[model samples]
Target: MTDSSAAPLRGGAVGIVTATLAVAAHGMAGGGWADGSALALLIVVSIGIGAMTALPERSTVLLLPALMAGQLLAHIALSLGAAEMHNHSLLPSTAMIAFHAAASVIAGLMIAAAERLYGPITSIVRAVLALLTPLPDGSAVGRVSMSVAVPSVDGTALDWVISRRGPPVSVY
Candidate 1:
């Protein structure tokens, strides 16, 4: 079994939190706090996914694809509805649905582009490392140098993205 002791939950937790914040911010843009409630479930699922990866028997190799797929669908949905969103609007329901459909396609493509740019190798490595490291709690240097991302990590850390495996057991 991999060293479960070393697989801290903070990184995945942070990812969930940040993702939730972003989602909430998007929802709040539409003038509602109700969407943020979904974030609690997101945090739980994120941590559970990470912890499952760290377990002794099963590997989390399969988890990433499903997680990625679900998130892709969600963001696609968000981007779709958000495109047609306005603080105040009285457009016809048909127009709104049509707009949302177009937007969903675009957002889905955006996620697809992100997946292609990052590639499976990069994505899997990051997922594994996120499961095994103090991802959310780190020094500035560590944050800048030793992190993972898809499209980006922090807003400014895009160029510093990682594309390698997790740290060796001895390094931990």
Candidate 2:
């Protein structure tokens, strides 16, 4: 992806993660879920994502949920704006709040699940390869293949095995 795209993409990731933390924390504070349970689930989901990201080439799996959730947010913003202008009703806005939150969390968990469903490492490799589209006489996909390459070595290998895939990756 272009730098412009990558930058926003990274931001989307950070936003989702931070958003997840905030909501989970809010849920905990609200006493909606057991103090530890909500946090625990969040941690597990985070760890699951990270673990799945680590597999040799499954890093792309990590982006799936982020992208999905990001798109959801973008769409929500657009529709919310229209709704706010037209209906003057808080319904869509309120639904966006609830649905967006749930969707993001679900997206995160689904990303983790995708990693598990398909070996992270292996899936990542496939994702990368998918970017290297072979030349054709002329085609859109062939014209734009830009998947980031997955590397063999990643930070603190063993810790990564157990660590949650959050930002600020440890340098090893």
lDDT of 2 by residue, 23-132 (tens): 44333333132233434444444444434334443344446564344434343333343432333332234444465566656666654453344445566888888789
What global local distance difference test value does model 2 have? 0.45
Estimated TM-score for each candidate = 0.27, 0.26
Write the residue-wise lDDT of candidate 1 on 1-172 in tens digits: 2233323432243234334543544344452332443445444554554454434443333334434433433344445344444354333234333433444344434433443344465669988988888456444553444665456445465544655577668844
Candidate 1 pairs with clashing backbones: none
Off by over 4 Å in 1: 8-35, 69-172
Output the TM-score of candidate 1: 0.27
Off by over 4 Å in 2: 1-73, 80-85, 88-92, 120-172
